[model samples]
Structure formats: structure tokens, C-alpha cells
Target: MASAALIESSLSGIPVKRGKVRDVYDFGDRLLFVATDRISAFDWILSPGIPDKGRVLTQISRFWFERFESVSNHLLSMNPADVPLPDDADLEALSGRCMVVRKTEVIPFECVVRGYLSGSGWKDYLATGAVCGIDLLEGLQQSDQLPEPLFTPATKAETGHDENVSFQTMSDAIGQELAEKLRDLSIQIYQQGSEYAQQRGIILADTKFEFGILDGEPILIDEVLTPDSSRFWPADRYQPGGAQLSLDKQFVRDWLETTTWDKNSPPPPLPEEIVSKTREKYFEAYKMLTGKECTW
Candidate 1:
């Protein structure tokens, strides 16, 4: 369970909106998004928390926000000190783990683009030879890079996992003009992110991005390119025939796979050793991908 003090301290003076792992606060026209020390697997929040997980995620997202600033407009504001934080806010202690961002009305879709076939895409491919209604090239192996990336948008689900929707479906929901713009921006961000990660010995297998409309224009909101939002694979260890080694939460997922716990049931508490190792993996990814220290 999350600590009451931690929750209250973080969400003070803001209307709390609870997600699986993050506690969001509405701060008038802006929002205070706090990454909690919670870990979730199989859509369930695990009992044991991963140390420094929040800071690592925050740092990675900030790094990508900076890297992609030239290409798109993101929700981040550069001057943290100028922003109005609570008087007793522990800003220094929460460095690199939180963001004070301009709040906009979020879109109803989750923008997903895949450069490679894997995970849910692979599952869909084996079932129907298509992913999110996009037909795949024949004989494409698992983890094989596509000839070109595809924009497969999905409708955001309210109570469960996001349901993959076709481009046509997206057009029906948000109209052809806005849908096309979202697709273009999604591919641009993914291309920049994949290229940058490739230089850092990591292959960004795929990633999800969220966008919101501000003053009648689309702006990128929420975190970008973090392990929680994207899948990271070691470039050298990536193999097509088997599961690729991940630099993210693979350790926890793998451990859970070996247990008898049903996926529908709440996951068992992770052991202390597993928690420590997972935290180290997050830290390692931050250092390797960003080329900066995990200060927290």
C-alpha cells in the first residue's frame, strides 16, 4: 500500500486524481503530476515498491522532453522556480521526479506508433496477420523491423486496457484533419526517439505518446520515452527468435511469469532482492540512455 503521508504530502493543495501509479493534482490551469513510488505489472499495482523508481522515470521523461523540444511543443515549462509551488513543497528533494506542466484537455485516444513487431503487436500478428487493423508484410518475424513505421491509434479505455483502433476508427472519432495531424506528429516523435536511443546502445522497440489541444493546437502532454511509456531493448542482445532482453521492468515481469499467480488476480509482493535489482535496472537505463547521473 502507498504511504498515507507520502500521498498526502505530495497531493496537498491540489485535487487528487489517482491512476495506477501516478497521482495527478489539478493546479488551476496547470497540473502537478507526481510519480509515486509504486510499481505495476499485468495491470496491477504490486505490493512492494521499487526504490527510486519515480525519480528515474521523471529524469528519463525530462531528458526526452528536452531532446524533442525542437521538433514539437511539449507541456513542460523551463523555469521550475518561477512556477508556483506550495510554500512548504519539498522541491529540492523531489528534483528530477516531478513536473509542473500546463494542463490542457487531453485527447480521448492513445497515440501509438510501432517501428518493430513485438509484444501485443506480435500477438495480433499471429492471430490475424495484422496489428491494430494494419496489415503486416508477409514472413515478418517477431521483433523484425518493419519496412516503415505505422501509426496505429487506439481508443483510450476507461476501465481496462486501451483497445487498439484502426486509423479509420480514429478518423471517425476525431475527424480526418485532426487524426492526420496526430499521426504525423506521432511518427516524427518516434523517429527522433528511436534514432537517439540507437546511438545509446538501446533500441526503442516502440512507444506511446499522448497529446492535448491548447488554444486550438495539438501539444504533447504527459511523459515521453520513459521505460514506463516505452519499451527499451539492449541493441546487442536483441534477437528475433526469442524474447529480447529488456532494460525496463522485465525483471519483475519475468519473475511473475514463473509464479502460479493468475494474471486476473492481484500479483504477489515482490521480494526485496527483486525490488533492489529492478531499481538498479531503472537507474542503469537512465544513465546509459541519458548519459547523466540519476541524482536521486
Candidate 2:
């Protein structure tokens, strides 16, 4: 089941910026998003891309985008066959991983929500008895489900760790009104997604969503809750006061922690076993949530 990993798309379109995962191409009024199999850890894009990673990421995102239609998003189409490209451009590599979307002015902050205590949010809570400056009751152990979800926003970083900022700081940076809107929408989306996933035997511990403004109205953009952007733990094995097994990139992160490679600088390449297992984790998340096998 080793599928081709498209580290980069060969399709031709007006040039746009490339990110750690998706490469975007400008097409006049629309944009083309090609999610590659590229995987990044500690902010470094590693070598030997995971097989079929792009297909899983793109398709899982499409499932969430379609399910959350109540929240307007930038998505236009996910079918590569329907996406227009220049003559002679090969789209075989982009199948099931391409999105043609309406372009908009992207908001610069990360809209994050946490249903469970984990990751950096756990670290923040341990030190401050609060996460993102929101006071929480003490004695909340690691991986413990929060009494209620909290809107914790971070500034998206280009080359380093995304700095977690308080709601007041976010309001100071963006207008208070706009900041409040993003917070509300982020919580709503996370709660709904978490509830659905819980019923399906997955715990969406936390997830991030991006939004952009189209004609002065905020619309969800970028990738919404994918394994790369969220922490998904299997419900059956869930435990508190410690780390939980996840079907997300955190699995790779846990492996990386045992390595001699420092969080800074270039990351080491993944072994065949690691890559294979990681691919299974990603595809399984897609299958478990969407209830359909990836066509690839």
C-alpha cells in the first residue's frame, strides 16, 4: 500500500506562497490549494514524505468542510478532475488532494479551541493555573477533559513555535469585535466536531481553524481540523494525568522526543517503520471519522 507521495505539486497556475503542508496557486478570482505529503515537525519539514499523506489530509479536510457548511468557508471544490489547469498539466498526483477555493484576506491569528487538557495548553496550565490567561480550576490533570471548551488563540509563526496569547492580547492586536467573533465561531466548531467524533470513537482533544474576510464578513479558510492541525485520541484508551494515544501528528512528535535531534534546526528523517505506521495513523483518522476508505 505504498502510494506515491507528492512532495510538491507539478500543476501549473499563477504562483502563490507555499506553506509547510499546502502549496497555493493564485488563479485570478480563485486559489488552488495542493496539499502535499510533506510532513513538518518542530517547524521543520522532514525528509521521506509519508505515503498517501496528502490524500488523507485533503480528504479528511473536505469531510469537515462539507459537514460544517453552517460556517461559511473558502472552499470551492475538492475534486481534482473538476479543477481547471493549464493544457498538458498533469493532475494525477493531485487527485483527492486539490482544492480550488475563493480567495480572501486571511486573518493572521490561529483560532484554537481545547476540549481536553494537553500539549502546550497543558504546559501553560501547569505554570500559570490558567491557559491563555483564562483562569481554570486547579487540580486539572493532563489529558483531563475540561469542564467546557475554551477559546485559546495563538499567533501563527512562520519559522518557530506559535506563541500562545491571551484573549485580551488577541483583542488588542485585532479589534475586540472581530476577536470575539473568531472566538465564538472557533468554540462552536470545535464543540460540534468533538461531539460528532466522540460518537464515532475519536476524541478531538483540540483543533485549530483559520478564517478570512470576504467583503467585510469573516469566513472560515485554510484547513479546518485535520490530523496535522488537531490532536485526535482514540476514545477507548483515553486516560487522564498522562499522554493519550492519538491518531494525529502528535504520534510523530512523541517519537521525535525520543530522538537525539533537538527541536531546533533540521529534523532527522523518519525510518521506514515510522513512516509506514504514521501513514496508517493518518488514513485511519480519515476512515474512522468519514466512515469511508480512501480511494487511493
Candidate 3:
């Protein structure tokens, strides 16, 4: 039997900040991040969340956090029980899907690094020959690898798609020194992740990172390099002319495109088959990347 999905988490006496797929509980010195099974596409949260989706995401992030220990990050503990919780809190539900992290003032921009021409980047290149103000060579097909990875920063929107902006724009909003540092760091991490994923027979096409100010220095925060934040493609099935199979929520997006519902309205509830397949894809990514089955 399949496990019931956790769409939302309600803890007593804890002030929580709920995003589309995660609930962040404020705990004075630290924060508890609970990844729910809720899935979103076209910026709309869909119904009937995928089973064990949150566990896969949280575990994958934990794997990367441990692997990148030399890198400064906000992860303090993976055990939610380490922090205070209500007497009625469900430890079983939170076991594999929560993180106790140092609280930091989150930066307002998404540090996106793209190594392939796809999605919005391909669309932007087709129309303007540039992506977020960085010009690329002509004649590049969809899914084609770029000459070099580009650090494209985007404004973090609360309720809609993150709008891509130029590096200069990011510098203007923040500062030149900080912006340059984030750009360099974003590209560096992307390169390391991409190379490693290729060895696992998966291609890390693009990814976005969130950073925060911790004790006067920038540290990586939020979910790290998971499928929800990065594009993962099977190396054996890749082609450059058009869309390739991805191991993420792209399955949900593709299914929605086949339906008549306009993206302006709330998305339709995902079918059972779609939900199951989506869950399988997320789990497959976790296994391939970590070399361990997603037991959670």
C-alpha cells in the first residue's frame, strides 16, 4: 500500500512560514524546514500530493549537504526532534522530511546557473539571443550545452515565477561585491554538481541556489540541488533539438499541457498515474544520485 502524502504540517504554538512545498517554522535561534509532498507547476500548487515526495527531496538535499561539508551552509541538523516541538507533534511524519537549520536573513535573489539551452533560457535565446542579459552564440538548439555555464540571477517573487534579471541589475539591487561573489559561487557549485552528475549517468542541466547572511558571511540556504530546484536529465536519452526527458516535476507540467485548462486558472488535480509516475521519477533521482534506495 502507498503511504499518504503530507500536504501541510501544522504544529502547535509554532509560528510557521508556508511556501508551496515546504513549511518553515521559526524557532528563535533555528528554523525547522518541513518539505511537504505538495507539487507545483506553472507556479500553481496542485492537489493530491505525490507520496514520499517530500522525503525524497529532503534526503537528496541532505546527501548534498553532507557531501559539500566544506561549503558553508545553514544545515544544523536533519532531526526535527533536536528542536522543541509541541507535545502532540507527529514525529513519524517529520522524521525524514525536516531540517533544523540556523536562521539567517535570506537574500532576496535566486542565484541561477544554467549550463544548457532549455526552458526559459532557450525561449529567451530564440527571441533575444540572450538569457537574462547574457548573449549566447547563435544556432544553439534546445537542450544544447552552452560554451560555458552562466550565472543568471532572478528576483525572488512571492507568488509567481521568478523574473530573470541581469547581473548588473542584481548588483544594483544588492551591491557589486556581493553580487559578484554570489555569481562566482553559483557557477562554481554548478560546475562541481554537473561534473558529478555526469559520472552518475545523469546531466545536471541547470539549478538555482538560495543564500543567506549568517554571522556576517553568506552561507547556502534552502534546498540544495534537488530535482525541484535543478533540472536532471538521463544521460542516455539526451538530445539537443527539442525537449528531453527530465527527472523532476516536468512530468507534471507536460501532463498539464495536454489538458485544456489554461495556465491562468488553477491547475487540474493530477491523475493517479501521473502522481505515481512523478513519485517514481523523484525516487529514481534520489537513488541514482546517492547510490541508495529512498527507504523513507
Candidate 4:
């Protein structure tokens, strides 16, 4: 495995916006998304990202986009060369980790779907017997599967954690019609993804989806079903009593919790063991889901 991580991408003279994990370059009608190997936990981008992490994310999104090609999305081409770039741009570094997509007027809320009781949902259930205004059944334990998936949207944040909001809150912010459409779409996709993962011995617990307006219609935007946006657990080791083994950055976050460094300050660099294990988990997910080796 390559130990070096591409934390950022350089496209001189091109207008670019860098997110925590992706570098998006602006074109008049299209955008170029480069998934750098940068990893973040607790709102902090940690040092020395897991190698080939970007490739795993990009490929996984590509796999799903192709599977659901009938669904409206922003993906145009996975090849970075399809987009215009500076003559001196490093296309080699961008290969297998970038997508050229149509630009749209982005919606401000994250369309989140939860099929399992975990994370903030667990916290909310423990406190209120509900998650985001939707009452859940009593006696549900952490990591327990819900009777059905819930569409819990959140206000998008540029720098920190996204604030979870109720479906009614989302309906109030956007029109009721649009909010309902997004909710239905999110749950449908989540069901398809969760079922597919189960067949592969993996559990797609929950995930976030982004949408944007294009030609007066909502189309899926940004990465889809990637580890960075979803919680994936091994099916064989599944347990509803507590947290299950995850294939995402939660492993890195677990290691950070054992450290003395405060999250408000700059996080400590990940040790070699953590980096290697995290990288392996990502690659393993790619292989299991797509049934192909991650050559990158």
C-alpha cells in the first residue's frame, strides 16, 4: 500500500473550493471533485491521512452511481481528464480519485437516513424516546435496527458538525412538497443500499445524501454511500446492545479518544498502526462491496 496521502490538490489559476475531504474546482456549467485522502474526526482534519482513502471513496460512489444510472445525479464522468484543467495540473495524482460533474444550485440541508439506532440517534432516543421528532419504539437498544428507516435531515455547516432537524423543520424551511420528495427519495435509496450491503455481509447502518436543483428538478449531488458519509459495520460481528465494528473513520476517532490532546486544539498525528488499519478497512469495504481489488 502507498503510505503517502494526497491531502490537497493543486490546479493553478482554477477557482477551487476545498472541503474537509474534497477539493472542488469550478467550471461555468460543471465542477471537478477531487477526493483527497484527507480524513477528519470530531471536526478536525487529522495529520497523515490514510493512503488510497480517496480512491476507495471515489470508486464506491462511482459503483453506486452506475448502478442507479436511471436516477438523476450530478456525475458526468469519473475521469478527471474530462474536465478542463491547467496545462500543468497533475492528472496522474487525480486519477481514480476525481469526478467531473454538473454544477447545480445546492440545497442547504443534508438528507440523512437512519436504518439502525446509533450515534446521535441513539443519544436522542436515550433522552427523548425519539429521534428528530419522530417517536421510536421504547426498549430499543443502541445499534438496534429500527422498524423502518427514518429521514432525519440536518442543516449543513461549513466548519463544524451539522445540526440535526426534524422533517417538519425541513418542511418549514423548504416547501412541504420538496421536503417530502427528498424524504421519500432518501429512504428509498437507503433501503436499496442497505439490502445490497447485507447480501455482501456488510451492514449499511445510516448515510447522508446531498441534493441540488438542476433544470427545476432535484438531482443527487456529491458523493453517495461512501464511508465518509455512512456507517458500515461487519454483518458477522453485529450486535444491537452497543456499537458494532465500523469500517469508517470511527476507528481513527476511537484511537483519538485514548489520547490526552483536546479536540479543541490541533489533533495529534495518527500513529503508523492506526493509519495502516484504517487504510485496510477502507480497502476491504471497496473489495467487498464492488467485488474487485483496489489496485490504486
Candidate 5:
């Protein structure tokens, strides 16, 4: 693992905010979002970093931003030449992983939309017969496609996992009008992304979106449509029963499940083979979904 100082030396300065996998540096009115090589599983940051993980995620997000521009506006300048990067900076080093974005006040909630039953939704359904406060028909199996996509809003927790909240709770948090707008826009974005992925032989099972307010208008912020934010399954192998193959970090999760390491403690380090395979999976997903090679 790279030391914190080593990571900091690679950047212009220390990050203003350090998340699990990305680092954010304040750059005047804009921000530099740098995706690191770190990999996390079971909500824990593991050892033995995966090479090019950042690049793969960055490429995936960039591809989606371009693809969705016809349907909605994203906070992207899309001009590498205009960015105020250091003269001696190695842009290639940051390839497939970094973005210079206009800074905006992020929303308080994580707008999650689901088209399939799995993960927390499946657990919630099995336990309480509801998912994000939406009741499902009895006998819905894992990975079963829902009749229609549903907007399952959640409150963004400060330092831990987010909690699913009812629609009424969301409305109370952000007012009825904004909540309604968020729901509508979330479902619209999901539908467009899901449909596009389906055409490319990938099933966008579900994904979470984050929005920010800029000039009193809501604009998409953070990464969009990446494997980190959504589950991608190969269309050819997808079945209504059993667990669906993930297009992203499914390998890491599978390895963790096999070990006796408790989810509460830090996850074990990934072996070189697992890291390489995971990186390949990410690249394969990008190529399959966008029909473009991941040059990085």
C-alpha cells in the first residue's frame, strides 16, 4: 500500500476531502477529483491495490457523461486542453481516472433507483416485505426484474452506511417539490442508462445517483453510471434466479465471502491474481458497454 505522503506527493497538494477511493482537491471554483488505486470490499478498504482501477472507473464515467449528454446536462467541460493542470504534470498518469469539475453544493440525499431485486433491496424485501418503503409482490426471487423501475431514496449518512428512507421522509428532508423532481429525474436517468446498457448486452440492475445544486438548479455531480455506482451483468448469462454476474468488483466480493474475515473488521488484502482479474473485468465492462477500447 502507498503511504499517505506518497499519494499526496503525486497530487498538487493535499486533498480537501478524502473519501474511501477518491480524493478531492479544492481548485478555486472548480475541483480536481482524483481516483486512486485503492480497492474496498465489505465497506472496508483492503490492501494490495489493483493497478489501473482508477483509470477504468474514470473511463467508464467519461463514457457515460458523453453518452448521456443528448438526454441531460452534466458538469463536464470535456476539454483537457483548457484544464489548469501543472505544466510538468503527467496527464497519462491520471489517465482513465481523474476529472476537473465545477464545484457545486451536493445534495443531502443519495438518489437510488432500482430495476432489479438484489443486495439490500432483496434483504429488505425478505425481512420486511418492503424495499425503500415500496412493497413488492410476494415470491420475488433474488435478481428478479421488477415490473417497473422504482426510485428508492436514502439519507446520506455522515460516516457510515446510508439508511433507506421512505418517500415521505425524503419529501420532509428536501421539501415535497424537490423530492418529486429528484424522483422523476432519477428514474428518467436510470431508464435511459438501463436501456442503453441493455442494447450493449449488459443489464444495469440498479444504480445510485448524486446531484448538486448550481445556481438554484440541480445538476449531476460526482461520477455517473460507473460500475462502482451500479451493478452490471452480462446480458447473455443473466438468469432470473441465483446471483447475477457483476460487471465490476464482483470478484473482490466473492473472495471476501469465502473467507472467515468478519465484515466488521478491515478486509483482507487481495492477491495479485484477484487484482488483475478485477482490473480486466472493469475494462471488459467498459468495452462491452461503450464499444470503445479503454486506451488507458
Candidate 6:
């Protein structure tokens, strides 16, 4: 039998705020973030969780979070013993997929940075000649590298899809200074990650980040640089003007597209082949980037 999915986590001390992929339990001044194997696509959490998916996601986040200590992050520890788990909670189940995190007032927007023309960015560029209201050079292909990474911020919607917005629109929502800081930090992080992933033969096409305020200082909150939050393409096979094969969740998304189910409510369960292939992709990314198999 496959490993049991950690879809919901509840502890004694505090209330839990469940997101699309994480089960977050408040810890007074901190929080326990548990990466669940439950895969979400087009906003719906798919059934029959992919085994080892949560561990891969959590470990990947830990790798980047440690590598970039120069930036303030919410992570405290990935060790289960360090977390404030309830007496009844399953210790073995939570071991590798959980983190003890510093709690903060989370920033409202998704700090997205794109280094390539793809996905929604490509669609927007083809239609408006810009992304998030930032104009780009004309005649750019579908996967062409942008002049530079663009900080495309979007609203963090509770339900439905996230709406992309202009930098000016972000500034209008949350002061110009704060907006500028987020944009700069986002671009800087993406640049460094792109460089690093490229060295490992993976194209860090684009990624989104979440931030929050801790004692009046902006800090990185939530998972960073995981396959769920970023687009990772094999560098060797990367080509412009078309879709690139990815080492992320794109495999599953591509499979889903073939199904007759509408992109509305109640998505169909993934086939065994798709599940296994996607798990392999996630693990491949973790191994390729960290140079070690996910022993957990």
C-alpha cells in the first residue's frame, strides 16, 4: 500500500488554517507548516495523494531556505521533535514533511517573478505586449528569455483564480515603497535561483513567493522555490517559441488536459501512471538540485 496522505493536521494548542497544500497550525508566536502530499491543480486538490510528494516539496523548500539565509525566511526547523505537535498527532507521519515556522502577518500579494515568456505571462505578452503592465521588447517568442526577470505581482485570492496586476496597481494597494521593495527582492531571488538551477541543468523559468511582516520587517513566509510554486524545465531540452517539458507538476497538468472533465468543480482522480510519473519528476528535481536522493 502507498503511504497515507497527510491531508489534515490538527493539534491541541491552536487553530489550524488549511491552505491548498499546507496544513498550518498556529503556535502562538510561530506556526507549524505541514506540506501535504495532496496535489492541487487549477485550484482543486486532487484525490489519492502522490506518495513522497510532500517530503519532496518540504525538502526542496528547506534546501533553498538554508542556501539563502541572507534573506529573512519564516522557517525555524524541519525536525518533527522541534515542532509543537499535539500528543495525539502522528509523529512518524509528520517527520519529514513538517516545519516549525515563525508566524507573521502574511503579505497579501503573490510576489511572482518571471525570467521567461511562458504560461500566463506568455498569454499576456501576446495579447498586451506586456506582463503586469511592464512593457517588453516586441516579437518575443513563447519561451524566450525576457530582457530581465519581471516582478509580476498578483492578488492572493481565497477561492477561484489569482488575478495579475500592474506594479502601479500593487503600489496603490500597499504603498509605493513597500511595493518597490517586494519587486526588487522578488527579482533578486529569482535571478539567483535561475542561475543556480541553470547550473544544475534545470531552467528556473519563473516562481512565486509569499512574504509577511515580522516586527515591522518584511520576511519570507511559506514554502520557497518548490515545484508547486515554480516552473522548472530541463535546460538541455529548453526551446523558445513553444512549451518546454518541465521537472515540476506540468506532467500532471498536461495529463489532466487530456481528460474530458471540465476545468470546473470536482476534478477527476489522476491515473496511476500520471501519479507515479509526477512523483518521479518531483523527486528528480529534488535530487538534481540538492545532489541527494530524498531519503525521507
lDDT of 5 by residue, 1-296 (tens): 41221132155543468776777767678877778777766667778767777767777787777877753434465443345766766666565467778888888999999999988999999998989778889999999999999899888764567888888998997889888988999899899999999999999999999888888777777778887788899999999877988887766888888889988876777777787777778888889987987665
- Residue 16, candidate 6: how far off, in angstroms? 0.6
Please report, in order, the local distance difference test score of every candidate based on alpha carbons: 0.78, 0.87, 0.92, 0.91, 0.78, 0.87
Model 3, 1-296: lDDT tens digits are 56899999989999998998999999999999999999988989999999999999999999888888778999999999889999999999887999999999999999999999988999999999998788888888999999999998999987889999888999998899999999998888889888889999899999999999988888999998898999999999999999999998888888999999899987889999999999999999998999998776
TM-score top scorer:
3
Instruction: Give TM-scores for every candidate, taking all chains together and pairing residue i with residue i.
Output: 0.91, 0.96, 0.99, 0.98, 0.91, 0.96
Q: What is the lDDT of residue 85 in candidate 4?
A: 80
Task: Look at candidate 2 and give me any clashing residue pairs.
Answer: none
Query: How many backbone clashes does every candidate have?
Result: 0, 0, 0, 0, 1, 0
lDDT of 1 by residue, 129-157 (tens): 99878887778888888888888888876
How does residue 178 of candidate 4 score in lDDT?
Answer: 95
Q: Which is superior by TM-score, 2 or 3?
A: 3
What's the lDDT for residue 39 in model 4?
96
Model 4, residue pairs in steric clash: none
Candidate 5 displacement at residue 39 in angstroms: 1.9
Question: Which parts of model 4 have CA positions greater than 4 angstroms off?
Answer: none
Give the alpha carbon lDDT tens digit for every residue of 1-296 in model 4: 48479999999998999999999999888999999999999998998988889989999999999887767999999888887788999878898999999999999999999999999899999999999889987899999999999999999988898999888889998899999999999998889989999999899999999999999899998999988999999999998999889998878988999999889999999999999999999998898899999897
